[model samples]
Target: MKALFISLCLSLLMILSSCEGRTGYLDEGQQNTVAMLTDVEWLVVYVDYSISNEQTFDDETNIYSFGRDTKGWTATGSLKDPSIKKDVRYFQWTFTTENYAVIYMAGNSTDGYWMIEKLTPDELWVVITASDPVLYPNQYKTYYKLKARKRQ
Candidate 1:
């Protein structure tokens, strides 16, 4: 009887300890860390996210500003020129290193969001998703992005 009781206790302890070791955890703090576009990287106009059906805009420019101490970042992307858009000047995207961001567009009908898909010292992929289409009100927008390595 003594041997049986001792064996039972040992087995229970092993089982509990093994279970504890198998649990998994997720840390949101390190999910999609990306470089701020305003401060670190220069904005290159390769793809435009603001071209709606009814708008006619012109040559645009953008600048970035990081939060006081990496708490977040803000982007002011503007639309100038009267050919592509009208009554539109600029938009702002506010973000954090947490990998998520929000862009408040300048035009009357433009607004959206974004996030970092991946980031590295050499290469990066920032995915941007937006809503409020000129023609398709029900459909949202999405942009998968890649950033080249900065020159030394």
Candidate 2:
């Protein structure tokens, strides 16, 4: 019984320590990256979510922004642009990793997996992957390239 107890304790310690090892890469750059992402509400300028379709916005009027706070991120505007009836006005967002995030939309509908292909204070690039309910055995994948809107 004592031997079994010691083995369990060692196993527990190993598991906890391994988890801590994952955070060693949180340097200044990572903080800056997150800060840049959360700081501004980006405007979508170009998109190529489909294999054949490419979409662009002529002006910032039909645009959206991502504003993140203590709770999480809030994505508003132009959600309908990418696809029909998207009309996503407000939703909660959370990052799964440095390069990936997930969005929780209204009615328990998840927008899908959001991947950050590129990020900068001036430019933000993202790709979202979701399933298509309308099309059986198909998925919805889109890429968006955005730029930070000039502050008025």
Candidate 3:
């Protein structure tokens, strides 16, 4: 009876040890991505419109902020556009994939999806794509590549 009790206790201990508690609702990769995104204020450094072939290399004052709330994340930024002017825009953001490779933003001024091409502690590159035939007549799909870096 003593040997059996010891064996049972050891088995229980092994099982409990194998079951590790989750750090958060998000997986490790997603948590890392979120941490990287929220850790810095991103400043747009480059922009490229695929259809128009327009590339802007000039220093941009646009700053992007990603809130860290796992339940209701937000993406806010100020865009300096001649047509739109410099207005602070707000959008709810979320990762569409389990790998956290894509980000979707929806708001009045910005409504699109961005595929994260590269993400690092200091730099981020995303390919923005949107498709709205009714809103954007004659345009089937549009692609915009944006590169941003952490503000110094």
Candidate 4:
């Protein structure tokens, strides 16, 4: 019994050690793609997804606003359903030094994060990917993948 217990402990340690720590996933070029992601202000081009019933619905409802911080450098933006309420909420987001990035929204804030899975400068498009949040953080949070064109 003691030998079995020791084996279980060793196995658990090995599994945890294998968990990779979070690191920026950007390449040099991809890093440039997001340079302005947290720089200039971004307006809502479209919201690619919304959470409902543990399901993600691609919501192209362009009736929204999203922008990066100019000063404090915090993730700042507001979202609303004009059909319902038009209140913008301030939230925090994380931008990776890597090409891939995420915008975290949780609490009275927003309970989740949005990751930029892909960005194409030539096409002027960004592909964001996120997961549905269930049973809290354990389940993937809602994904608000956004494909936006720089606003002039």
Which candidate wins on TM-score? 3
TM-score of every candidate: 0.33, 0.57, 0.61, 0.37
Clashing pairs in 2: 49-142, 49-143
Model 1: lDDT to the true structure: 0.39
Candidate 2 has a TM-score of 0.57
Please list the C-alpha lDDT of all candidates, in the order they appear.
0.39, 0.58, 0.63, 0.42
Runs of candidate 4 exceeding 4 Å displacement: 1-27, 39-85, 96-100, 106-108, 121-138, 141-143, 149-152
- TM-score order of candidates, top first: 3, 2, 4, 1
**lDDT score for candidate 4 against the true structure:** 0.42
- When 2 and 4 are scored with TM-score, the better candidate is 2
lDDT of 3 by residue, 1-152 (tens): 99999999999999988986764477878879999887766656666665566554454445666778522222334334322224566767777776888777777566777778788887788766674333343543434334444433
RMSD of each: 9.6, 7.4, 7.0, 11.6
Residue 38 in model 2: shift from native, Å?
1.3
Per model, state how many residue pairs clash: 7, 2, 0, 10
> In terms of lDDT, which candidate is strongest?
3
Instruction: Write the residue-wise lDDT of candidate 4 on 1-152 in tens digits.
Output: 99999999999999999987655355666457556464333434333333554222243232222443312212323323223323445554554324345444443444444545554442223333334321133543333333333332
Candidate 3: misplaced stretches above 4 Å?
Answer: 1-24, 70-86, 131-152
